[model samples]
Target: MTAAGLPMEIRSEGLPTRVRIHEVGARDGLQNERTVVPTEVKAEFIHRLAAAGLPTVEATSFVHPKWVPQLADAEQLFPLLGDLDPQRLPVLVPNERGLDRALALGARRIAVFGSATESFAKANLNRTVDEALAMFAPVITRAKDAGVEVRGYLSMCFGDPWEGPVPVAQTVRVCRALLDLGCDELSLGDTIGVATPGHVQTLLAALNEAGVPTSRIGVHFHDTYGQALANTFAALQHGITTIDASAGGLGGCPYAKSATGNLATEDLVWMLHGLGIETGVDLDRLTATSVWMAEALGRPSPSRTLRALSHKE
Candidate 1:
């Protein structure tokens, strides 16, 4: 290993030449924090992420403050990022009202959160899976009409806390429903992080068989069981180019008790770069940003790559 902790480059065959990282630290990373970060600090965090070469950064969520009090400054924080490309900054909208709030702020891209299981749907949305899909239909339609791109986040795709292991067909059904409802792309979330690499490949193959192209899908894997990277490699082998990651491995489902922090962007980038895959991300800069954010939160980052690199410094 190098002094900076970077792995030696080795290009692997059958993997995409480049991958698009969907940075969720600004939103997902901070949303679960009990410590309320100031609006200015949140804005700086996004700015740092963008400067670090993260092309797509999820800015904030338009969900009500009562639901996610940490991101309650969405309104105040979004406007401050006016200088960034609007298409690169995606916000989360829970319903028509959330979409309205986001549209008012000139958000050009947005994402809707959903679940593949009944238990998570009821716990997170207080609605059945079908009812939740119904709620997102109008919001997605309106977003399409407004010419805004919409992404669908399907949580508990592999397993659920209350529902144990989810069936592949059950997950595929919701994925198809989200695509049919007009989502531009879908993110399959291993929320409780129980997915194995074989399970990942099986799900991708099943989705492809069900007519969902791998091009229109992304993988969001948490490191709860330490399978995030292994699962991500399985997805890359299946031609999935979009990945959802949190810098410094910060994030978890507030609704899912067993869920943990997402796959660390530093770890993902390190793996990508070492594999000779182009992600257009500067590893050093990204690691520094994570360290900075960790200090802001008054704690050390959980990302193994971040800890290793920062420790060497």
Candidate 2:
């Protein structure tokens, strides 16, 4: 570490020179909050993320308020973010109605959340795996017709609490389906965080063999078993560039009790910078933002790097 709390730059062999971090703090992070954050605070959090140079920050979800009350203020919150680039502020749209809500608000980019396992599909979406994919098909098609970019989030790509270890073939089939349905990118989510480095590489290779290119793939790993960073490095070695991370190590699958916080932005950035990878983010500013958010949430951040750097500050 340097005197300023930054990591020493040491370039890694054959890694992408730059990585696009799809910051999910405001949308994914706060959605799991026990209490509903004030709409203005959510707006401010997004502004801070953008100012910290996160290229794509998921702004909010247009899911029905009955489902996710934490983001019930999506309609009110999105307008406040008009000052930011709409393309960079992707929102989650669960169905056609959700897509209509997001489009009415002028969301230029949207994401559809799905599951790779039957249990998660039923528990999270109240449908079978195939049924959930069918539901997303029209939503994705409509988004594409409207010229809105769509990202597919496939949770439980590695293991499921109910189903145990998910098969690589099963994951690749669903990934290809989502891509076939017109999703511009797919974020492989180890929702219960049971993935190790080898499992990650295996899944990535399976997807590649199934004709899903690494350039169109991103990884979202949870740190439940303390393997998120290691799994991420495995993906990096396979040429997967986009990563989904939450600030302050916030967010877990509300439907999956065993799931924990996502791969923390602070932790990921520390590793990426140490490897001399470019993320275009201001580490100090991002850490400060997470610290501020931790205070607002009335808890200490779970991020090791955030805690360490903030202590020095």
**Per-prediction tally of clashes:** 0, 0
* Per-residue alpha-carbon lDDT of candidate 2 for residues 205-231, written as tens digits (9 for 90 to 100): 988888999999999999999999999
In the range 1-313, model 1's lDDT, one tens digit per residue, is 6665678889999999999999999998899999999999999999999999999999999998999999998888999999999999999999999999999999999999999999999999999999999999999999999999999999999999887999999999999999999999999999999999999999999999999999999999999999999999999999999999999999998898788999999999999989989999989999989998999999999899998888777
Q: Give the worst 10-residue stretch by lDDT in candidate 2.
A: 304-313
- How far residue 284's Cα lies from its native spot in candidate 1, in Å, is 0.9
Per-model lDDT: 0.95, 0.94
Which pairs clash (backbone N, Cα, C closer than 3 Å) in model 2? none
Candidate 2 wrong stretches, greater than 4 Å: none
Displacement of the residue 170 alpha carbon in candidate 2, Å: 0.5
Top model number, lDDT: 1
